[model samples]
Target: MTSTNKESNGSPSPSDSSKGLWRNLQFARMFIAYALATFGDWFDALAIQVMVAYRWGADPLIIALIPVCMAVPGILLGSVAGTLADRFHKVRIMLLCDVITVVLTIAILFAPNAIWLLPLLTLRAMMGVFHIPAQQALTRQVVSEEHLFQASSLNGFVAQCSKVAGPLLGAVILAVFSPQFCIVINACTRLISGLVLWPLRKLVQPKQWEGKGLTGQTRTETESVLTQWVRGWSFIRSRRIILTTMLFGCFGLLAILMIDYQFTTLFRAIKPGNESLLGWLASSVGAGAVVVILLLNRLPQIGYGWGLGGGFSFIGIGIAALGWVTPLTPEIWVIVWGLCIGIGNGLSMVTMNYLLQKETPPAFVGRVFGIQNSLSSIVLVVAPLVGGILIRSAGPSPAFQYIGMATFMIGIVGIVLQRVLWAEKKSPVAALQE
Candidate 1:
């Protein structure tokens, strides 16, 4: 197997690399298309919630099922999607998924009731499950190693901006127009993303498959999708750096997910009359993420340990402070805490992407992300239920404190483990190649 350094002199300086990354037409196209698609996703997400809770008058249990519908596809088909991303041309997969999503988003507009909407939502989410891994894999193909962190930071920035902007725009549209209108807007964005990406079919050429397959055979023959799917999990397990980061990352996720949804309840307790502040509070988190993404882009380097550990710690501290909010507590303080968590969120995400690209061989990048998504789905399903029970019985105050501390500890432990486990500079891609 041959690994060509895309940048001259083995590694280009950070400033040069950043400029090159922006100049790369493939990355530029992807960035614009991804931003449009992500904004549309968040817009439709808010639209769906309003449609179910307000329009259809869904009960709490039914409303809770919304996330379950979205998550179930990732749990079931995520790894399979990854295998498909690895087996086929990733650009084609991304383009196909975008087109399918455009169709499904339009179909969502016609659903008269929650029953019909749920299935369409699930199918749309399934397309996302396929789209994400393909996008991540393609990113590895286009961005050189020197510029990966910048690319990751830029992507995170787009996502954070979309999170803030999409819901706000959706709210405005929903007030002036209708949920169906918002759904239509989402469909148009998807269509636009597809059109933007269509030209990449002729432009970005993927590296030829040069290494042995994960099943210990040459890439001359195709492996069954099921075999690749199963091997994806084992492949992660075989690499210590990937496995450790993934496990600890999920731990942090469990801690965050537990308290994330309960913020509304907490806000209600602190300031019962102004549930509207919740929007500001949520936007604050996105603001924090954007700040951190910008900071990361300016930095010459990012340490994986610092990104994961510091991220966990910041979020943990913020969440813990958030638990202490009382009627007497100032609203400004709460927004500050939310901002802290957002910074951590951005840091961890960018680091995770950077690590995956740095460590995983090109052959297995898609499967790695797919397996990660599946694991996250498991945490997503379990965390909310447990958090709800804890909050119901113990109240949000104690629940936040406990969960926040646990999250903080996860970060501290991650740092200590990184020191021990990564004492040697291990090259997972090189090891896999051998």
Candidate 2:
């Protein structure tokens, strides 16, 4: 592959230099399935938070447990999930995940009290831990290297867009039906995503699933999961591009998650009973992401260090600004500030991911991303709990300020990583390598 894919970046992969507006049919199908599933997840997210806060009378600490419960399993089990994704048929893994999700969503409907929400959400999150690595690995396998950047960008945009659409859909649902019904709607969407993937069954199988190497040899594959796990971890440790960006991105993820778990609280703090305002604030993020997605080809053609560090710095500024300016101070200020956060999220996340994908091989994609996801979960797991406590003790306004500052600190970390990478560039071997 070339250094840049002109369709998404400024150039193209060596294999397919021609430009195209859409990924091939196979990738397109997967996108549809994924988008449907992501929308469901967003809807469930909004419903759960609203239910926990309004229906359960959950304090910030208790509500914080919801995201914590969902994330902790990723930290604990993501390695296994990533390895399994490589070993198994990714399509089957995705299908099974959806099936399990449907079952779990129904289980939530029958849950006797809000206490059950955490455990159920945790199970669903774990299922996702398996599904996501597989999907990422599978996408790399199926999509052309030339199209990967655009495909990844489009997929990322879809996921973020769902965050906008799902919450808005949830707002409408809550307006008409009980929050419990949102769980049911989510379950149905999961089923839809699975059904959509059914057509790819015969075509989506990779060599790894057939007990062979990616190159189609009856290779002596590592017999032990432990060995595979170690290889994966070792790969993550060795790649400065992956390792540093993963660590730096944590701050942005933390800031975003804090806002995620605390959105209702933030909105209510501004104006209680303004249920739809949360959607409006959340939608602004999608708006910002849309701007970047639309301008995908126009982004500065820079090296990974500059692209990732500068992008993260931008995200940090936006997030910190949002935290510093609480909603109640001025509603328009909060809404407009959300656009900044979203734009940062889009630019930083897309750039970092593209860099990671460019560096990762098909064989290691699952494990590398698995480690990345797990590392991210470390922040995701802790941010909500700490944010809850902060919200309770410091109130949403100050709590938000703290989250924003934490995110801003990540920008500093990114700059340092960029400098270190630039210094390493003098070494021809590593700099010359992918």
Candidate 3:
């Protein structure tokens, strides 16, 4: 067989350059399934937002609650979910989550009104709590370690592509059909994705926990949920680099959340009554992210330190610039800001996550990632409410200015902390080399 044909048939192992693009048929199936599922998620978000705003006449903060519902579960259940991911067959867990999410989506179709959305959204979020870690763990299982960065980048790319497409499709669907109909379509998409994953059972091996001996150990001492949860924290504390990286992530997410909220509000101000413009702004961000992914794919040897710091610096400067440009005439400057944030977000996400994955021990991967997700969710939960209040009290421009300043300060702090940590460690490059 030709080399290409051998690779296609899962016979020839992939080289680093082709790792992300040349997944085996089984991995390709899972990738497509994940892409479709993510599309369904974004579709649901767009449909639900429009339904809540136009039909229910909900206030902006109230509308924000929809995302809050989605994020809260990830924050609360993340560690436990990570533990479970390490303990169970990850693919089976993912399949189960997809099924549950599909059921929840269908339930939303029959939801009487916006009020009914809360409960359904809660269920969907809970499913995500199970889905995300399992999905991450499974990706590690299917790919070689050298390919992990590529796999992660490709995953981010697909997610960004969905963000670009799903809302626009939902908008077209909403114009032609009801939001309930969009929900139905989402349910169908999720159902098909779930079915596609169901047959991949052989790909998911049981975790190392199954091999551990604790025959005479008490449940509390051996397999307690509390112990499992604490184990994640303990793992973090033992690794100085991991702890430092997580701290950076926490501050970075806090700044990112502030920027995200302010940018959405700024978009409204810049193009009053033009919701499609907001969609375009979002698409611009996704487009920027796609560019970052493509660039990183070509330059695999670059370290995370420069990418993380530089990306945050760009985001900070872009956010600050938005405050200055909002008063200008053309109004397209908002799009430029959107593009900057998008590229910055994309680059930062990939590099930071790659660093974490590379540095973290395989046994603790789920827990570390879970903690990162929880930190981001916690920031998401708090930022919007506080941002709204700040805007109400001090107007949009000042709120954005404050956000930019805060983000900049945080970036500076991250840089300083990295320097200090490096200085303290005798071998600075060792921590980052991972």
Query: Of the candidates shown, which would achieve the greatest TM-score relative to the real structure?
Result: 1
**RMSD of candidates 1 onward, in order:** 3.9, 5.9, 5.0
TM-score winner between candidates 2 and 3 = 3
Better of 2 and 3 by lDDT: 2
TM-score of 2: 0.81
Model 2, 1-434: lDDT tens digits are 33122212212234442545352545666899999999999997878777788887877877757767888889988889988887767788899999999999999888766677778888989999999898898777776555667777787788788877888888799889988888889999999999998766655344332433323234355568887777677766776656766766675677667656687886677577568776677678789877776566454233555555656566566656655654346667767877877776777767777766666666667787788888888887676667788789988867777777766666666666666753333321123232
User: Top lDDT: which candidate number?
Assistant: 1
Off by over 4 Å in 2: 1-23, 50-62, 115-117, 204-219, 255-279, 297-303, 323-330, 387-406, 412-419, 422-434
lDDT agreement of model 1 with the native: 0.83
Alpha-carbon deviation at 28 in model 3, angstroms? 2.1
Q: Assess candidate 1 and give its TM-score to the true structure.
A: 0.93
Task: Estimate the overall C-alpha local distance difference test score of candidate 3.
Answer: 0.70
For model 3, the superposed segments whose C-alpha errors exceed 4 Å read 1-21, 56-62, 204-222, 267-277, 412-434
Candidate 2 Cα lDDT to native: 0.71
lDDT of each: 0.83, 0.71, 0.70
- Candidates arranged by lDDT, highest first: 1, 2, 3
**Could you give candidate 3's per-residue lDDT for residues 1-434 as a string of tens digits?**
44334223312245533645464555676788898899988886778887889987888867767887888888888888887876666778888898888888888877777678887898898888778777776665555556667767878788888888888888899999988888888899888888888767655352332322112121233566566667768767866767777777677777667657565577667556666666666777888888888777666544555567666766776677777655444657667877887887787788777776665544456666777778778888887677678778887767777777777676666565665542233222233233
Tell me the RMSD of model 1 versus the true structure.
3.9
